[model samples]
Structures are given as structure tokens and as C-alpha cells.
Target: MHVKFLIIGAGPTGLGAAWRLAGHGENDFLVLERHAHVGGLAASFTDRAGFTWDVGGHVVFSHYGLFDRLLDELLGEAVLRHQRESWIRVAGTFVPYPFQNNIRRLPPELAWECVEGLLAAGRDAAAGVHPDAPAHFRAWIDRVFGPGIARLFMVPYNFKVWAHPAEAMSHRWIGERVSVVDAGRVIKNIIFGADDVAWGPNNTFSFPLRGGTGEIFRRLAARFADRIRLGAAVVSIDPAAKTVCTASGETITYGRLLSTGPLDRLVADQLVGAPPALIEAAGRLKHNGAFIHGLGFDGAPPDSRCWMYFPESDCPFYRVTNFHNYSPFNTPDPDGMRPRLRALMTETSFSGYKPEDPATLLDRTVAGLAATTLTAPDDAGRLVSTWEMAVDYAYPIPCLERDAALGLIQPALEAMGIFSRGRFGGWKYEVGNMDHSLMQGVEWADRMVAGSRETVYTL
Candidate 1:
């Protein structure tokens, strides 16, 4: 079979492209998804005990107006708006999100240490003692946040989340994702005893009222279900013939191909006759996997905070979300009547740099929760249902070699009528959020159908 446009992996990016193409009244496109269901990494699952959980801790927040309008149209009144109440667990206490901004919440001595380090960092900047540009993420953290915050939170927490050493990762991708705090603001907040909690774009976000985050994509996919081919994983791509072969022995020919799978696999494994340099470049692109655990309890939640970060090793998971708070329906009670069930979702990342034993992860996660004071020792007995998902491609690591690698691979693919744009496909963490991923596809479709210039997912 043949088509004008062919999309691989019916995740946010592929769905966005198909949706936009359909909106433009184009009908020659087909979406091929390996999974039987939609939503990709953004998919959700309902456990045996009726608790809903996302692959990871995904909140509905957008930097684009297009995404906002789409959400409004799709979810309508069936959505929940939340003021983000995120915190960090450290130094035997809970510090507000952006741990650098709330050092006062730490123990007095630790707070002073953080303050002193901030003062030292300020002095270094004033004196022009540090380099104009930090070499890597580690240097950037030390230069911007100083030693105390770096040692306590930035270094350890980042290592856990990314599963990569700070020195190996690039610092450039940290725009807006990280909060940069100065000494004066921190000191002033500490003096006033104020909580500097509202610093990021996700301070206020939205969620589906019934299903988990996956509900958004599920509803979108239903619009053109006839065009989507589930369980059809692409096995090979003959770029010269503009043909794709699926695992089911189906051969599809297309004028244009949009690949939302991993860039490395697209180049090194699937594409035919890929140049040696391009294949090597693809190999250099790094990524980490994630283990998501959804733990359901038979009692009320332990806290009011939306999610909490753990920099310490007491918890195998780097972050935990009070999933029940995202939506009451996330628990067993759809009517919001029974406040007895608690849903806690945890995310732990792993890569070659950091290995985890999946066999022992669940037990360690439960023990870690108690060790971090998220639950009591006896609460383990109250655990009614537990669900876990291991994602192979979770976060795309922004390593030092990423840009150079993309530089080599993306252009070659585009020249051959293949456009790869998404979290793993584009291999850019800065624009890898849900809104950005969808916009990348929309932009790609706009460019394809209307000669519109693509802005997001540019090399």
C-alpha cells in the first residue's frame, strides 16, 4: 500500500501530525503504532483496585496557546485545574520546590551553609573568578547555586533523575526547567520567612477529571481511529524506495515519513544504507529509562503536597506524586465521596551509568517511602494494589555530544523525506514536554501541507 504521508509511532508527535493533517482536510496519511493502545509514553493505566496512574508524573501544563485550545475543546468541563504544590525532602525536612529558593526551610546550620555558599558564589561572579561559560551541568550547578545547594540537592537529585553523571551532561538545556536563585532574593525570603513557591510555569496546571493524563490522547485518537494501525511496528525503512516494512510483513510506500521513534534506532537499525558517520552519530545520542510504580493504599493520603522530590538515597525513586490529589477519580471513588483510598506514584530512572535491580525495586520503593517519612512502617500492610511499568525511553539525556550528533543525523533523514520530531526522535529535552512534542508535529504538518516554516524541533 502507498500513502502521501506516513507517521510512525502513534504517540503525541505522530497523533499531532495526523490530527493537524486531518484538520487541513488531508486524507492520505496513515499512523502506525506498535502498541495496541494510544498515548505513547503519556498513556495511563487503571490498576486492579481502581487507582489510575500515568507512566510517570505528568501534569497538564502548556507553554503554547494551541495546546491550551485543544485541551479545552477535548476535555471541556471534564478537567481539573491544580495549583502545583511541589516540595523537596531533604535534611530531615521538606523544602519548597526549587530547593535553592527555600534554603530557610532546611535546618538552621544547613541553611547558613547554603546562604554562605550563595554569598561566595555571588562574590565569585562579581569578581569574574568563574569562567564565562560553564563546561557542563556540574560546573553550572556549582557556579549558579554554589556548593551547599549543589551538594545537598542539585547534584544528588539530578543524578537520580537523569541517571547520568552531571559532568557528562550539557548545561545548555536547563532553560526554565531549573530555577536560578540569587543570594539577595534567598536572603530576603529567609528574612521575611516567606515561601518562594511560585517560580515555574507549571505553578498552575490541569488534569483530566476522570482518566489519567493519557485521557487527552485517547480522546484525540478516537477522532481518526480508522486511520491508525495498532500493533504494526515498523521493522525496516528503505529510504531509496520510500517504503516501510512492518513486523506483520506489510509493506507500505509513502511520499513522506514522520518517525517518532528513537532517532538512534531510526538511523542505525531501521533505515537502509545509512552512512557510517550518521550511524555512529546516532549511537552517541544517549537516553535513560524509567520505572513507574503506582502504590494504592487503603487510607487517606499522608500529605497535601502534589509531588515531592527525593535527593537522598533513602528512596529508590527520585520523585513521588500524590496521584489521588490530581483527581479524586484517580482513586477508587469516582464521585469523590470515599476519601479512604490513597494513590502514590513514584518514578525511578535508570541507565548504563546507573543500574537498578527491577526484581527488588518495589520492595525498596515501599521501604524508601517509609524511610523518607512518606509512609509509616505499618502502612505497607495497608497497600491494597501495586502496579509498575518500565519505560525504555523515558528522558533523553542532554549529553555534551547530543547537538553534534543531531547535527549529523537529522539533516540526512530530512533529505530522504524522513522528519523525526518528538521527545526521543528530536532528542531535545528542552522541547520534549507534551505541548512541545505535539507542537512539533503540528508544525511539521503545517510545513508539509501549507509551506509553513517549522520552528520547534529545529537542529
Candidate 2:
């Protein structure tokens, strides 16, 4: 198929580009998705026992109006509005999220430690205390939250979630990604035991009422169904020829290309003639994989919590989503008489830095859930279905050298008629949320057709 525009990977980014192109009366484009479905890393699945599971725990929260309007249009009345009630399990206690702000939930000694550190940090700041510029994530944490919060929560929590030490990562990508503590409000909440509901961008988000997160992208893809070639994986790309060869051995050419796959995969694995330095830089781009373990219960959950974090070392999972709570349809027997019929999706990070033994991962996850009190003791036998999914590129680790690598790779691809944008495409975890991913594609389309400046991906 020859077209004016060729898109690789039919995820949010590719869909955004295609949707935007269609808005411009430009239909001479084709989106090639390797999988039989859209949504990319944002896809969802149903287990044999009838529990719906997303790629990871995805919630709808947009920084762009375009994304908001599109979500409203696609999901319509099938949206499940939710108030985000998230928690952190530390010192064997469930504390409200933004662990620093809710340090009072910790034991009195620990709480006193946090408060003392906060007061000391404040005093230091007042005394014109100056420290060296924070060049890494660990230092940034210490600089912002002081040693107390960092030692108690930030350092340990981040290590568990990222599966990489904070000292090895860069701090530049942390723009509203990690909620910084408000010392005054934290003290107030701590003194009064106030449970603050609103915290992050996803404090109030929504999901599909029925089909998990994938339903949104499925409906969005139906808009230009004819132009989408499902299960068409790009095996090779010749930038000079402006053509892509699929795994099925079909040769399709395009005038322009927008890729939503991993930048490393495109350059090192697919694209021919990528610069040597670009290839090396791509190799240097560190990212961790994810093992999404879903468990379906015949009974309800321990609590009505939306999601919770496990920062301690005992738990294999960093975060566990009350999948059933997201939508009743996520449970097979939602209307069934069982008191605790629900689903819990746990995310475990795996990479070279944190190699996970998959054979016992599910076992570990179940134990972790019980240990963290996400499920009841008897819920083990009640597990009707256990589903495990692996994502090779779950998060783009913002190492100290990440931007330098992106600088070398993206411009080279752009000059060669390739615009790589999305969560993994751009690889900027700060702007790598669902909304940001779609907007990256939308802005890319706008940039291509109207010469508008792209913001999220910053091309």
C-alpha cells in the first residue's frame, strides 16, 4: 500500500496522528499494527475465567483538551468515573499516597523522624543553607524532601518501582511526575490525621465501563478502520526509499512516516543506515520491563481502595490495582452473589537490574498481596484465574545520559522522514502518560500538516 503517510504501531500515538490527519481531510495514510488490536502498551485483555486486565493499570487523565474531547467522544456514557484512592504500604502500615504528606500514618517514632527532618530542612533553608546542585535523582530527593522523607519513603519507594537505584537516574524528567511534599500541609494533616483525597493528575480519572482500557482505543481505531492493517508488523524500513516491509513480506511505501514503537527497536532493529552513534545511544537508553500479574477472586477485595503501592522489599509488586473496582464489568460474575468477587492486577518491574523469576512470580505476587493486606487470607483458594503478561518496554528510565541519546537519535530519524513519538517512542517518562502519548501523535500530525510546534515530545 502506497500512501501519503505511513504509521507504524497503532497505539495511542499512531491513532492520534491518524485521527489528526483525518481532521485535515487527509486520508491518504495507513497505520500498521503488529498486534491484531490497537492501544499498544495501553491494550487490555480478558482471561478465560472472564476477568478483564489492562496491559498495566491505566487511568484516563489528560493534560490536553484534544485528548479529553476524543475520550469523551470515544467512550461516551461507557466511562467509569472514579475518585483515585491510592496508598503506600510502608513500615507495614497503609498510608495515604504522597507518603511524605501522610507521614503521620507511620508509627510515632518514624513520624517524628519525618517531622524533625522537615523542620530541620526548613530551618536550614531559612538559615540560607546552600547545597550543591542536584545532578541526579537521589540528590534531588535529598535536596527537596530532606534526609527524613528520602530515607523513609522516596528512596525506598522509587527503588522498588523503578527497580533501579535513584543515584543512577537523572532528575530532569521529574516534572510533576513525583509529588513533592508540602511541609506545612503535611504537618497540618499529620497533626489532624486528615486524609487528603486529591493528590496527582490522576486524582480524579475514569476508565471504560466495560472493556477495560483497550475499549477506548478500539472505538477510536474504528473511526478509520479501513486504513488500519492489523497484525502487519514492520520488519524493515529503508528511509532512503521511504518504504516499509512487513513480516508478511508485503512491501509498502510512504511519503512520510510516523512511528510509535520503541526508538531503539526502530533504529537498531529495523531501520537501515541509522548513525553508529545513534545506534549506540539507542542501546544506552535504559528502560525496564513489566510483568503484569492479574488474579481473579470469587469474592470481593479487602477494601474499596482504587490502588496501592508497595515500597517495602518483601512485596514483589510495586503497585496493585483494584481492577474490579475500576469497573464492575471487569469481573466475570459482577452481578453474582459472591461477596468478594473481584480482580487485582499487580505490576512487577523486571530488567537486567531487577531480574524476576517468572516461575514463582505469581506465587510471590499473591503472597505480596496478602502481606500488603490487598486480599484476605482465604482469598488464595478463591483465585479463579491467574493471568501473567510481560511488557519488554514498560518504562523509559531517565538515566543521566538519556537526553543526550534522544538528541542524537530523534533528529536523525526526523531528517530521514521518520517521526518517532509516544510513551516508548519519545521515551520521556515525564510526558509519557496516556494523555501525553496521544497528544504527542496529535501534535506530530499538526506539526506535519500545519507546521505547529510539538510540545509533549518537544520535536
Candidate 3:
């Protein structure tokens, strides 16, 4: 079989590309997804007990006008708007999101320690004590937040989320993703006892009223259902011949290939006759796996916060979302008129540097939730359903070697008429949001159809 454009993986990127191609009246494109279902990591599932859970915590907020319009067109009135009420759990209390901005909620001594550290950081900056740019994320944390906030929140919380040591990762990936706080702002908030919760781009987001976050992508994929082939995993790609072979023994020759799979796997395992340098570069690309737990309880949600970040070891998971709050239908309540269940979605990241025993993760997660005051000890008995999924290629680590690896691998593949984009494909955590991932594919389609320059996934 042959096609003008062949897209691997029916995730957000591939779906976006296919949608754009069809929108532009181009029909000679095909999408091959290894999974039977679409939406990739953004997919949602309804447990037998009737709780809907996303692969992890995902919120619908856009950085592009195209994505905004697309969401409006897809979800319409079926979407719900939410003001982000996120917090950090530390010192036996809840500080508002952007913990640095609202250190006033902490115990007096801890808050003062954070304040002192910020003052010291400010003085150092004024004196030009360390003028050189930070070499890694660790130094960047210390330089920007000072030792107090770094020790109390930034350092530990980051490690929990990334599953990699800060020193091994690059600070360049932190654009709007991280909120940098100053001594003055922190001190002022502490003095006035004010909350500074609206800092990031996702301050206010949208969600599907019925289905979870996956509904957006699921609806988008239906438009070009005939062009998608599920359970057709690619086994090999011969770049010289522009051919792709699936595990089902079908060889497809394509004019141009768009791969949304992990860039490392594409170069190291799938691509035929790759050079030593490219293979070595692929080996350097780092990523962490995620263990998501969708715990359903026989009561209303325990908190009003949308999600809470856990920095201390009291919890095995880095973050927990009040899943039921996102949508009433997320719980098993048949009528949706009166809610009776609480859905807690927790995400724990693991990597070579930080390994977790999945066998006992559920018990630990339940105990941790109670310990952290997310649920009462007796609430474990109230747990009616437990849904868990482990994603091997979860967050693409922005390591010191990432850009260098991408620099070599991306160009080499592009030279062979293969383009890799999306989260793992581009390996850029900064632009790995849902909107960014979809736009990367849309931009790729634009480039293919109109000779437009691709901006989101550029080297």
C-alpha cells in the first residue's frame, strides 16, 4: 500500500496533522495507531465502578488561537470552564499555588526561612555575586529562588515530578512553565496575607462536561475515521526506500512520513541502517514513566482544590487531582443530579534514577493520601474502584544532553523525509503541553500543504 503522507501514532499530534490535511482537501494521508483507541496519553477511561480518569492530570488551556477555536468547535457547550485552584501541601498546611508567591500560609518559622533566603538571593543579585548563567536546573533553582524556597519546595517538588535529579536536567526548558518569584512580592503577600494564585497560563481552563479530557481528541479523530488504522504498529522504516512495515506484515510506501513515536525508539530500533552517531544520540535521550492511580471513594470530593502538589515523602505520588470536581459525570452517580463519589487521580513518576515498586504503590498511595489529609484513614474502606495505568514513555526529560541529541537525530531523520514531533518525538518539556503537541502536528500539516514554516517543533 502507498500514501502521500503516513502518520505514525494516532495521538494528538497525528490526529491534528490528519485533521488539517483533510481540512485542506488533501485525502492521500493515513494514520496508523498501535493502540486500538485514539488520544494516546490524553485518552480517558471509565472504570467498571463508573469513574472516568485521564492518563494523568490534563487541563484544557490553550496558547494558540487555532487550538482555542478547535476546542470550541469540538466540545461546544459540552465543555465546563474552571478556575484553577491548585495548592502545595507542606508544613501540615495548604499554601496557594505558586507556593513561593504565598509562603504566608506556611508555619511562621518556615515562611520566615523562605523569606530570608529570598532576601539573600536578592542581595546576591544586587552585588552581582554570581553573574554566570546557571549550568543546570539545580543551580537555576538556587539562583532564582534562593536556598530557602529551593530547599522547602522547588528542589524536592521538581525531583518528584521529573523523576530525575535537577543537576542532570537543563534549565533552558523553563519558560512559562515555572513561576519565578521575588523577595518583594513574596514578602508583600505575606504582609498583606493575600493569595497570588493566578500566575501561569492555565489559570483558568476548560474541561468536558461528560467525558474526560480525551473527549476533545476523540471527537477530532472521528472526522477522519476512515483514514485511521488502529492496532497497526510500525516494525521497521526503510528511509532510503521511503517504506514502513507494520507488525501485521503490511509494507506501506509513503512520500513523506510523520512519526509521533518516541524519537529515541524511532532512531535506535525502528529506522534501518542508522549511523553510530545517531544511535548514540538516541541513547542519550532520557524519559520517565508515570504510574497513574484513579482512586474512587464513596463520598463527595474531600477538597475544593483542583489539584495539590506533594513535595514531602509523606506521599508516594507527586501530584493528585480532584478528578470528580472536573466533571460531575466523572463519578458513578447515575443521575448526575446528586454526587456520591469522589475521584482522586494521582500521578507518580519513575525513572532509572528513581525506581518504584508498583506492586505496593496502591497501598502506599492510599496511606499517603490519608497521611497528607486528602482523605481520612477510614476513607480507604470507602474506596469502591481502583484504576491504574503505567506509561513507559511519559514525561520527556529535558536533560543536559537532550538538545544535542535532538540536534543530531531530528535533522538526520528529516533528511530522510521523516519528521518526528509531539512530546516524546520532539523531546521538549517546555512545549510539551496539549496545545503545543497538537499545534506541532497542525504546523507540520500546514508546512506540508502550503509550504509554510513550522514553528512549534523547530530545532
Top-lDDT candidate index: 1
Off by over 4 Å in 1: 336-339
- Residues 127-206, candidate 1, lDDT per residue (tens digit)? 99985799999999998888999999999999999999999999999999999989999999999999999999999999
Q: List runs of model 3 lying over 4 Å from the truth.
A: 334-339
Could you tell which candidate, 2 or 3, scores higher by lDDT? 3
Clashing pairs in 3: none
Q: How big is the positional error of residue 232 in model 1, measured in Å on the Cα after superposition?
A: 0.5
Question: On residues 389-426, what C-alpha lDDT tens digit does candidate 3 reach at each position?
Answer: 99998999999999999889888889999999998888
TM-score of each: 0.99, 0.97, 0.99
The candidate, 1 or 2, that scores higher on lDDT is: 1
Give residue 200's lDDT in candidate 2 (0 to 100).
79
Cα displacement (angstroms), candidate 2, residue 28, comes to 0.7
What shift in Å separates residue 269 of candidate 1 from its native position after superposition?
Answer: 1.1
Query: C-alpha displacement of 94 in model 2, angstroms?
Result: 0.5
Give lDDT: candidate 3, residue 169.
95
Alpha carbon lDDT of residue 325, candidate 3?
87
Off by over 4 Å in 2: 127-131
Worst 10 residues of 2 by lDDT: 124-133
